[model samples]
Target: MISLPLLSHAISSCNGPCRDLNDCDGQLICINGKCNDDPDVGTHICGKNPPPPPSGGRGSGCSQYGTLTCGGSAYPTYKCSPPVTSSTAAKLTNNDFSEGGDGGGPSSCDGKYHSNSERIVALSTGWFANSSRCGKMIKITAKNGRSVMAKVVDECDSMQGCDAEHAYQPPCKNNIVDGSDAVWSALGLDKNVGIVGVTWSMA
Candidate 1:
């Protein structure tokens, strides 16, 4: 098993020299010590330092998270997401997972649509980690002092989007937790608010 020291070494090697996934070009991901086009390698081989939160609206303090243009609209997207913390910070956004819903298609993990009343979520690409967290339960805590348990059902793509599969929506941010209506209601948050700050952890 890889130790913390080895993980740290991998991260430093990626940033200082050219050894890990960050140094790879194109769709290749790091596995062991070589770059390969295997999605199953997962993303835990390297640690990503969190970029400071954007202080203003679009285009402000968004250099870390690059931009993508889709349907005449530019969206901010991240190549790398923040490392998980004790209470990993994230942005909770509304999502519809039922058939013919705004979530686009069947869930990535199970390939089935879930009801809005189900406490399910679609995590950002990095956290999704090639479906590594599929079917897992997580605890989400909102600022309103409410919390709920949600199951991981899909991935909110952070790398690529603006396609039919993605419902032409822009790529998701690296720290997003796209939750269903039940999650919001359980947290005592109004879905009309759209997005809100929250923290979560594996349950």
Candidate 2:
């Protein structure tokens, strides 16, 4: 049961933090455990939150943490910090679909995988570790002045040369922004092999 004071608080504080659905009042919804003022009415869930962390479930650490690989599967199973909304300069590249790199057959964000689609992108472990940014939207701008908005769908494996944050060591030769075939075409790059200097930002 909801009390008068609780209901008043919930109604007046629709955008405030919450622990459960009941914390929100009226049409407002509890999302990512927080009450959202402008939630996706269709889904009744805060549209900002990701689709939950990798198969291992949510983590409680920093976004720079790495993942674990077991039994031929890779899981970004580290405690994650809050997602960062700041934009960063990233080196974009295309991933060959020869292997199940689209987040291991299914997208880590929405659990849907489209091999030939270009609306999806894979971020490095450092970026993906911030679970909040998983399903968040990102704007990518190519050097050619073409820009596209993409959703973060998968985590680019550091072992496969996705580590690009090394300051002194010069990263694994790539920051590895793995985009879908459509992304490559949108950036006007050849899908066979290409690199583009791009900037990305999250809202």
Best by TM-score: 1
Residue 53 of model 2 has an lDDT of 38
Alpha carbon lDDT at 193, candidate 2: 57
Local accuracy of candidate 2 as per-residue lDDT tens digits, 123-201: 7656776444687778887877888887777766442222222111212222456777777787777776566777777
The digit string of per-residue lDDT tens for model 1 on 73-139 reads: 6666665567776698899999999998888889999999999999999999888988999999999
Q: How many backbone clashes does candidate 1 have?
A: 0
Clashing pairs in 2: 60-79, 61-79, 61-80
Candidate 2: residue 200 lDDT (0-100): 76
Q: What would the TM-score be for candidate 2 when compared with the true structure?
A: 0.47
Q: How well does candidate 1 score on lDDT at residue 143?
A: 91
